[model samples]
Target: MDLPQSQLVAAHVQECNFVQIIEGLVDSSHLGFLHIDTLRKSDSSDLAYAQNVNSMQHALAPKIGVEDTAFGFYYAALRDIRKEGESRLQARVAGFIAPFTVLNPNGDLHQLVIPMTDTRSMFIHVYSASRRRSTRSRYAVSTCGWWAWTARHCSDFT
Candidate 1:
């Protein structure tokens, strides 16, 4: 877990269950809904965050593609976007390690789920990310806070 390019400048902890936290991590579809204000479509000019509209609005349904890897599997979430009058595809890739670890293809973000007890869990996240270029979640604040907060336990699913 050593990246010469980056070092731990700081760290913190937040309130979330081990199961629910991972659930939210893999459930990329909720970005449009859960993070509507943040991840939702912004404008036509920004091609980096384009959208694929359907009958209702910009559709965020990603075409998930997975490939087996030595560690586990790597996956790509491809989304169609429109520019001018043409349609194009944008892909975001990420990889998972067995047990509970996820890495962004860019190598800028990493998250691990560590269970503290039956009800509390710790999300140890590392990022060498720039705010302007990185896609951060609203939940990021909690993942880096030291306060002893607790989220509803959803470990029953495990």
Candidate 2:
């Protein structure tokens, strides 16, 4: 017998009242700058996690394309990739589920940004990718734990 599809493998609810978090989610331009210490990495034996940053895709102003979908809105961030005489557009697509849900392209990650009170918000994150469970879990743990441990030192955003 086959089982039904599960959209949510794990859900984590966190308090992140920063109104700018949503903006940070939608903006690819900050990927290189703000998350210079975080974001982007895989299983690499030689390279340390702290030494890896997806610089190629960071600080890039992607050609944004948006369409009103039945569910809500569909947006694509197109990055230019060229080699020799060849040209291509690498796309990262995301779907906004009306009020606050966002289905991200990678790791089957979905985020729901809900405002609870002034200066307080709940970020509901759901991850569905089961194949790369360990990698995803490590990344999530590093991001949450490491960021929390070092957030106090980050003063540029304010």
Candidate 3:
């Protein structure tokens, strides 16, 4: 059977599919690096470039909370798993996501772990469309790079 649409329409459709695949691949590729630094170390990948903590200490550390607040406060609290250490370490996470649009899912932007079941797990992500002030502050190199990758994919998601 002969098609009525022009060749340009077919080309456009293919282009759109290509873009979606690229975006999806980028999303999935982020999982390994974002979830853990283990893969990066074994592969000698630059993905494990966190500057603030040494690998040995990081391995022993319990958990770290990264937080940003409406009062223009942002910080990270490092908890010691051993509980033997009295001091807690902390730092401010860079950049702010505008309100009503990109605020953290649980009044916070991200969470490392949430248990859904005995074996299965769930991770929830919340994104908004509201606009807010941009500080133009210098963000960490890794953060900036991820933002750049996401920005490109945002055209499809947004």
Q: Highest TM-score among the candidates is held by which one?
A: 1
- Residue-level lDDT of model 2, residues 46-158, one tens digit each, is 33322222432342667788889888887777777554567666676777777787776553667777776655455656656443232233223323342122222222256
| RMSD in angstroms between candidate 3 and the native structure over all alpha carbons | 17.1
TM accuracy, model 3: 0.24
Per-residue lDDT of candidate 1, residues 9-126 (tens digit): 2333545567677666655555666666554444443533333212113446778898899987777777776646878776667787877887755456677877776656766677
Number of colliding residue pairs in model 2: 0
- Candidate RMSDs in Å, in order, are 6.2, 6.7, 17.1
Q: After superposition, how far is residue 119 of candidate 1 from its true place, in Å?
A: 2.6
Question: How accurate locally is residue 32 in candidate 2, as Cα lDDT from 0 to 100?
Answer: 55
lDDT of 1: 0.57
Q: For residue 10, what is the lDDT in candidate 2?
A: 36
Off by over 4 Å in 2: 1-15, 37-59, 83-86, 132-158
Query: Clash pairs of candidate 2?
Result: none
